[model samples]
Target: MPTTVLVAGFRGSMGQKATAMIKRDPELELAAVYSPHLETTDPAAYDLPATTQVFNQLSAMDTPAQVWVDFSTPAGAFENAQFALEHGMTPIIGTSGLSDDQVAQLTKLAKEQHQAGLLVPNFGLSAVLLMQFAKQAAQYFPDAEIIEMHHADKKDSPSGTAVNTAKMIAAGRKQAPETVENPVETIPGARGANYEDVPIHAVRLPGYVAHEQVLFGGPGEALTIRQDSFDRESFMHGLNIAIKQVNRLKGFAVGLENVL
Candidate 1:
């Protein structure tokens, strides 16, 4: 049987890409769509099957889907995930800006419901491998920093990818490493945000799609792991994998690395 999927923010770029990918895969089915902006009674209006339901809100979805794919705004991500869990649907969240407390709450909810809640920062397969490589490198060189670059329209400052990488590196270490001494800056905020003593620098520019570099330094040399996504298609492959495997994951998982 095809896995039923409800896509929130189906009109947006990532959402649209996910929708098309889901439709193409024989293992997946488009059960419904939720978009706050676009409205249409006809399913063909969004290139979906006529049988698929369109909803402006979660409450309007009369039938519960097995999976909820969220690529909406930060404000909408948490609510969509909660709604999915409450309705016994697994949520695969692609949006950022969820706080630690909010994640905890959602994880608890998923546990109670015996469903999975996934918060994926970046669904690009190469990006997931980059994070894994960074974790491996961190074991040898504990002194490291991350720089993540994204398009200017990105809502978050430090990309979730960078934050997740830092956390993963921290997890691999038995003890916290000493902080690096920085050169004095004439301007404040010159140094990037610190996550578990790891510096994260975020760059938002017009031309870049998505890029990340993790640099680790020791006494003699430094190791750098970099990955770049020139287009949105880089993410869909990993998204498809998540949609297929989420049901088997019966608790909250933070990254696509878990599925990989």
Candidate 2:
């Protein structure tokens, strides 16, 4: 039997794409879809056969779904994940903007239940590789900064991927030397936000899909690693892999790198 999966936020862009991918794959089956805004007739009203049942509320769904995939808003994602975990269902979370405290709480819950939950801030393989490269270069430079660019409509600044990268780099280093002694500031907030002693600059523009650059400076040498996601398809491959592997994991796991 195919693995049964329930996708929340089924009407959104990424959610729809994931649904199509699941439908096309032979090893997965879409057991249900939950979206507050979408009704049961919405998909069929457009002359599309409903491959999965739609529910306005997650609690209303009675099907025994094995895996729950979240591609919804930050708050919605958390709520859906909590419900899934309480019900003994594995959750693959792709939502961004989750805070450190929230992540810790989820991790604790997963441990208590002995269930697995995955939180992936960025699903693009290039972004994962960028983080891996940054982690490797942290020891040599010890000083670094991040610049993240995303579409203007994005709700969160200092993308989660950038924050996670900074945390990873910080974890690998013993100490980060202060970059400036007497920092001069022409403006009040000219310098970007600092994550774990690393500076992070966020750029929100109309044209950018998602892009990030990690720069390392030490003595006379500098190194830079960059990644870009030009289209939504960049995330599908990683998301598919996470969905398949999350069931085998216990407790909370962050990043696609672990699964890879």
Candidate 3:
């Protein structure tokens, strides 16, 4: 039987793409779509069946689903996932901005319920590969900085991809990464945010989809790794993979790279 999937945040950029991708996949069923702002949008605007229900919350829906693929906002992501877990459904979360405490709580809930939950920071394959490559490169370079760029409308700074990359690099390195010393700070907050001693710079502007670069320096040599998402479709390939493999997981897994 095909996996029954409900998509939350169906009106957002990524949500719309995910809806279309799920419709095209024969192995998955588009069970329903949910968004708190559903009333403000037109149903005809979506490319779903005329019979499909678009509700504001999971509790209001009567349709049965085994998994909920949530690309909602940070505020809604946790609530949606928690509702799914409570209803005996697995949750696949793509929304960023969830705190570590929230993740820990979700992990504990998933473990208690014996449900496989997936919380992916970024779902683009090349992005995931970039992170893996950065981890491998960190051991050699040991000093790195990240610059992540996205469309101006992106809700979060330091894209989850950049934070995850920094963590991976920190894990792989032997010594602590270096920071600029005696830097003249004419303007505060110019150095960007630091994660595990690695600096991450966030850039938001128009005409860019999603892009990130990791630059490493050591002993007169430097290496750079970059990943770019030209369109939302770049993330679909990995999302499909997650949908197929999440059912087999014993507990919660973060990052699409874990399943890949």
Q: How well does candidate 2 match the true structure in TM-score terms?
A: 0.94
Q: Quantify all predictions' global Cα lDDT against the true fold.
A: 0.87, 0.85, 0.88
Candidate 2 lDDT over residue span 42-147, tens digit each: 5565333466666787657776678899988987888888888999788888878888888898999999989999999899999999988888888777899999
C-alpha RMSD between model 1 and the true structure: 1.7
> Per-residue lDDT tens digits of candidate 3, residues 1-260?
98888899878999989989988998988888898776533456676787566677565767677889999899999988888887888899999888888999999999988889999989999999999999999988889999999999997988888988998999999887676688876888788887888889999999999999999999888999999999989999999999888988888888997787
Candidate maximizing TM-score:
3
Model 1, residue pairs in steric clash: none
A best-first ranking of the candidates according to their TM-score comes to: 3, 1, 2
Worst 10-residue lDDT window for candidate 3 reads 38-47
State how far residue 81 of model 1 sits from its true place (Å).
0.5
Order of all candidates by lDDT, from best down to worst?
3, 1, 2
lDDT (Cα, tens digit) per residue for candidate 1, span 1-260: 89999998888888889889988999999999887766564788877898788887566667557989998998888988998899878899998788889999999999998888799989998999998888888888888889999998898978888888999888766556766466686886678898987889999999999999998888899899999999998899999999888777769999997886
lDDT score at residue 15, model 3, on the 0-100 scale: 92
The superposed Cα distance between candidate 3 and the true structure at residue 58, in angstroms, equals: 3.4
- Misplaced by over 4 Å in model 1 are 39-41, 180-183
Higher TM-score: candidate 1 or 3? 3
Worst 10 residues of 2 by lDDT: 40-49
TM-score of 1: 0.94
Model 3 bad stretches (over 4 Å)? 40-45, 180-183
